[model samples]
Target: MFEELSQYLGWTNCFPEGESFLVIAEGTDCGFILQHFIHTFLKRKLPVCLVSTSQTFSHYSQAGIKIGANLDKAREEKSIHLVDLMSKFLNHYTGQIECDWNAKNIYLSIKEELDSMEISANSILIVDDISVLSSLCLSIDDIGNLLHYLHALSKQRGFNILMSIPSLDCEQVQDTQSIAEHYADTVLCVKSLQTGYSKEVHGQIEVVKGGRSNCGVRQYKLSDKNLHLFARGTSMAVL
Candidate 1:
């Protein structure tokens, strides 16, 4: 999983069962971080559902192979499910469920799918970059409704809800952003380090609030299979 980084933001301390987390990453590397995160749970054979609006299922499949995850086995065992919301852009639909921006129906669809499959304590629902909510022309009210629905589902099923929402300042973005921050059990803010000097460090994160509030900032590097951590002045060789 996160290895040494787990002492900070990994599930070992960050995302416990039946909790909710909001991971805010301003950098593009959020996707890589998320891939490894998903791979970690799959490695543990936890039931996982990924609602993707950013990438196609094939992209995730390739990432699984890159990370050495038994994705095929996980799929066969019904341990992992990917819900693709972007495939329709290519005039195709292929996912555990084809999701839309409608709040109520989305929740019902997700609940129905999870119900039809095996779910357990270690189960988790990951919504890749909730920024898509606003990007898809959803209003603040719409986003709020969606968040509440997902939060309820998490509580009802005893699984965690993990979402990545970028920090934006527009009125509409601001409207729903606060809901995510306030609604989460933990918040992991991911952003690039403002190093006075350049280095290999990928980003910095902090548990600004929530269940694990006061967690300090830490820098990390991302490989296809791992998240490597380093302190200031520590050489990559130390990793």
Candidate 2:
């Protein structure tokens, strides 16, 4: 789905082992970035785990279908796990491994499940959006602690985690988001397309923190079905 994006960013071999990343983007665009990342991981036949906070399993399944990611098959094959926390958001229990709606509970459940699978190391964990946790009225300290624990887990095991959050915000939410970014090994920021000359492109992704050397802004096109990436004509490196 993102052949060009992968080529442009050299992502095919960029994400090193055991690295954790933070992705921040505008609404809708966040979904595209996550889908693109998931596609890349699936190509490598790696174990993918998702902790959904804003959407149900079905929504992501449909999205994965568009990218030729047979999520249902992946689940049956145990190649992927969707640890959903949006049960309440979906009006009932939806998590494959149900747990309380708090971060501690979610973390404990995931850790236990991964341990049982014996593939806790060398895996990927994708979080839909952290801001939704703020909406749950979780304190900033609680959010920070959660991030710290997740970060430590990633290091202990040889796994990577890619989390998404909104870049623009105010108040306590902003504080939590900032701390999350700080814990990440790499950071990506996606914003609405800045160039006015092209309608095919929807936005650009910036490497806000640690990333492969020479990583910079690249024009991206996000639609209802796919995400496309193009090299920039000029050097507008976010660094």
> Whose lDDT is greatest here?
2
- Note the clash tally of each candidate: 0, 0
Across 195-223, the per-residue lDDT of candidate 1 in tens digits comes to 53244676766676545556566667676
Candidate 2 per-residue lDDT over residues 1-239, each given as its tens digit? 67765665456666557887787775435787788777777777888888888887788789988767887888788787877667754553344453345668667766765665535455788888888778666678778878888889888888888898886657776786789878887777777765553556567776755645346777676666666665665423431
- Deviation in angstroms for 100 in model 1? 7.9
Worst 10 residues of 2 by lDDT: 91-100
Candidate 2 regions exceeding 4 Å error are 88-102, 194-198, 211-213, 223-227, 231-239
Score every model by TM-score.
0.83, 0.83
Consecutive 10-residue window with the lowest summed lDDT within model 1 = 88-97
- Runs in model 1 deviating more than 4 A are 10-15, 88-101, 195-199, 211-213, 233-239
- Residue 3 error, candidate 1, Å: 1.3
The lDDT per prediction is: 0.71, 0.72
